[model samples]
Target: MLTDTVEIDQFIRPAEIEAILDQAAAAPDSAIEAILDKAARFEGLSHLEVANLLKMDDRHLPRLYQVARSIKEAIYGNRIVMFAPLYVSDYCVNRCAYCAYNECHSFKRRQLTQDEVRDEIVEIVSMGHKRIALEAGEDDVNCPIDYILDCLRTIYQTQADLSGEIRRVNVNIAATTVENYSKLKEVGIGTYILFQETYHQPTYERFHLAGPKRDYWYHTTAFDRAMTAGIDDVGAGVLFGLHDPLFEALAMVIHNEHLERTYGVGFHTISVPRIRPAEGVDLSAVYPNIPDDETFKKIVAVLRLAVPYTGIIISTRETAAMRKDLLDCGVTQMSACSAVGVGGYMAEKRRRETGEIDPTLTAQFAKNDERTADEIIAWLMSEGLVPSWCTACYRSGRTGDRFMALAKSGQIKNVCHPNALMTLSEYLEDYASPEVKAVGYALVDRELEKVPKSQHREQARRNVEAIRSGKTRDLYL
Candidate 1:
């Protein structure tokens, strides 16, 4: 068993973080441009260099964004991987002030049964999403490790009558023991995500009035135990509005660095989520650090430069305009048709059909981009972005350091790009409106030519033909 008494100071080191930010605030233009040049060469920046980029003037923000885009294209090409969130239970024992599902709220509590999970899975699969991020609030007794394991089993086995099924299930529940994580790994889970909420200990403690989450060290180091338990692919994040965005950003990078030094790999994915006011939660003490749109873009751009190989995620919390702009700034992953409450997908479908809102339904936080899967898919195709439903890496035994190596050496695109187009083909054939199908097929034709005429591309063509003919599905390199 890993002890919570491990030295947290060695990893986070707030004093050192402040000192680095202090020096970066005065960095000259020559130094900043040189750092940008290094980042453009695919040499990731240090924590101090990332901080300096954050302090750059608004006049130079355009160059920063340009370098970010160049690096993204260099690594992953013009594809955007898509997934959706599934909230199973909202019953909580934590008093997290920013969450609508915090225990202090007055709404009725709910936990989905295994049958209900199947219902949700059918809804998600029908929307043509192959990846699912399973979410739940922190309540051990009502939502224990056994219950979560059961939910995972149900999600994997459940198939939509529309001839669809979820291909990946990424679990994002609270911190737990290594034993529980091993159980999750046994069930073939992908990416164990738990956010640090706020790395500033005082703010974190103040906001989390009561609960197991109030333990600063334990929550901050969950990934350490996760990796030790052999869950190689893990995701990390901070609630950006909980503290100074720059500080949180630096700490997050440092945490990743620590993982690289301790284990052989770092965070496989990084999420950037901002706080929004919830319907029944208090936010009296959370103030002054909310990043404006321009500032948020800067954070994303610098993060892209600092962690050139890591996947950056921008959730549906951002507006459509902001999400569109962020695609150019460095966001590689996005959530479509997301619902942050228990059974939100099916409930939403009914609401759209009958114009009836369920009074009992509540969300963790409201989503900013509320478009359906087809609408968002059409918009992505119109913008020349290939909406990918690819889970090739997870299924092909290429994750953690192995995946990172392929990505860094520029060989990942050999398989990833082709897999992306084939999956897009799958979506069009399975569940797309006439308008969406027209847009998607044209994009696929244009994109297929961009794939160099290798066996990968040829196989992609054959697999796509197989999918369209309804002979074989779920094909990849």
Candidate 2:
């Protein structure tokens, strides 16, 4: 059954998933320690093992957090990768019940022109973000593949009026054919991200009522066509509140397993986005299924152990407090100063001081964290976390199976650590506020000492001074 093609039925079996969770509920306490020990060693866990850990009682929660933190420290070190989201359009053909941009809504729809995208980039770069996830709603006739390509080209090529550059662009769009994905690859996208929304076919169909997205097989197999087209680094996720979170988690692990067996690599990143309040969606049917803070932490920790090699992303949908707490439970990447709407960043930035609204800004979902990117980055540093701006791996040739091998062997730290500090140096020089710049530079020096090799530390020191003296930009290992 493990063939070259993607089969939805084989990838996610609802009955099999139900049985796994049911059995895990009766698993002895000893099973928990055994699984946690393996996870601590970074061997990763099987879906059945993850299911049992998901059933961990309140008493085992501390050990779960400790193992997850240890694995994160061993693999990714202490830096949290940061990126921002730029919504090109909220125009859509879908009537999904959980979205604010559901086609039925009468809100004004807008897509960024090349000029508008340049301005958004100016604002985004001004905030010190070197990477961004390009977001848009699904509408083929109105917002064609050509438009998406144009936006990608504009993002990568334009040197904004303001002083900065967006080095990496990750795109999230509707499912399409292999040829279209190949075109995106040619246009130079970093990661081709598509969320499964939920793996339960019945609920998937129910929520995606009136769009091409309603096709369960096409939506689920998106990664297959993408990888087939040679875009191997794809990020996968679910909306998280649509079905039982435990079942969804198990199904997602199975989905990753299928990709690995067929394509020789699993997901490059896994995003855990919880469904939140949207402009026009009916949430009366959704509130009951939403996971509270404690349950959410449990799921995130289990996911860390379930897929140890992949980067896990949490957006600004969660509160700043919760995002801070999640670090201990193994979240490696987060979006800072993110905009969930077309032109939201610039719109919010200009009126930020006065609290005025920008008419052009329209959000797809409510964001719980309202902090500016700079404020958040400052808070992260104060809490002893490195706010990294590195895209060296992507810009370098390390991706897909190549990146996986380095990450699995725990050797990525050699380059990633120095690369993160070097980029942080660039951010400090070009964008950081005077006070922030001073603190950031000091932190860079301290972390530079831990760069693992005398040679790397020397090179990083020279690069930092070069950036400080305005001699170079975009230096990487």
Candidate 3:
């Protein structure tokens, strides 16, 4: 058994979590319903309450899913915020056992030059993505903080077809000092996303055999530093299948609670990424705790109930059917038509146009949802859902506890709904295919009526009309 680590105790008490899990396993139907009632109120749940819901059996899962959907609708409505990943580099010094970028891998490593970064952003913009999560492997020598800032400058400055550009760039890189985070904030990043990989200290130390990432305490405390450095919006998550899923889920709740206690706000978003097969890793041997489809859905639902106000993100790692199912279970954000490798967008476009695969282009992980962005947007519209590209809150100064206060008070919809429609209209006019554009226009027209009439609504209407008439672009409330 691994010895008790101070880091673990400082964040989460394993024995307390375990004891709550045991109690939850034996919770009666009335007790479970009481917990669901609490979730419905959007008041947020305690760690013990979350553990009980996680311990629920399949018999109670249907109710749990229903409550989750209701809570999601109450908070975020039908708008699904869309983004794509832009991997600028694959260089690494870490020897993580479950990643292809592990230092022990024999594959060729590559980092994009400023020109290559511009090209990638162009392709991404042409696909109608206003938001991107810039990803990179850890390597101070190759991908230092300065390189990251330069890439950010390149992305924000490079204009795509018809003056389209990346409006938000959330970064997913290795943890560094508060000074580095402040630098990223100065460059105008949307969110500082860093996955803990796993919250279990022993499991974290085991997977990260060699590198700066091997220090569990340093990695776990990264959010505190970022928040202190004045980056209000931070995203946290764990790679499921690394350890017991229940333990990881409970630990996530503990983490969010800690952030709320210390920083006055928790995670702005919580990403749920399950481990998948990679070049250097044996999926089955290294990650034996992978959850089945039902189990995974339950986890997402529980997370929704546990943190009703925080945004939940579902990535392209899941299948189309699974992603669709999860949307109702409180997933407010999603990555559509994502490419997970360095220079992956260019490579994928080339492969689609010509039937040749680029041997030099390596993917960080294989994608399960391979639909194009247009297809995903069209499908979402057909289902009465709005595929939103809105970044108004971040730009308009509604971040951190301010945003949370509005979200909790149910007033954000007035702003979010109108902005979502305006951005959707802009997408239809600029980047969408004919078929998608037709469906999207109809959806936008119908959704316009739903936006409550006010000064902002009138402005959004004018912006939508301007976009339709080719007078403006990238307009949001």
Best-fitting candidate, scored by TM-score: 1
Steric collisions counted per model: 0, 0, 0
State residue 323's C-alpha deviation in candidate 1, in Å: 0.4
RMSD of 2: 2.0
TM value for model 2: 0.96
Judging by lDDT, tell me the better candidate of 1 and 2: 1
Tens-place lDDT digits, model 2, residues 1-477: 222344545568788899989989988889888998898888888889999998877788999988888888989988999999989988999988888988988888998999999999988988888899999899998899999999999999877533388889999998888888989999999999999998988888878889988988888888888988899899999998998888888888989988998899999999999998888866776546777899999999999988888999999999999998898889999998788899887788778778889875668889899887778878888887788889988988899999999998878988898888888887778777888888888898899989898888899889888888988788888
| lDDT string, candidate 3, 1-477, tens digits | 111222333776667777877888988778889999988888889988898889876788888989999988777878999999999999999999988899988877899999999999999988889899999999999999999999999999998766479989999999888888889999998999999998888788888999999988888888888887889999999999998899899999999999998889999999999988877678866678888888888999999999998999989999999899999777989998998999888898899899779898777777799899998998888778998999989999899999999998889988899889988988898888988898888888777777776687678778899889988776766
- lDDT of candidate 1 over 197-237, digit per residue (tens): 98988889988999998888888888888887889999999
Off by over 4 Å in 2: 1-9, 161-163, 353-356
TM-score of each: 0.97, 0.96, 0.96
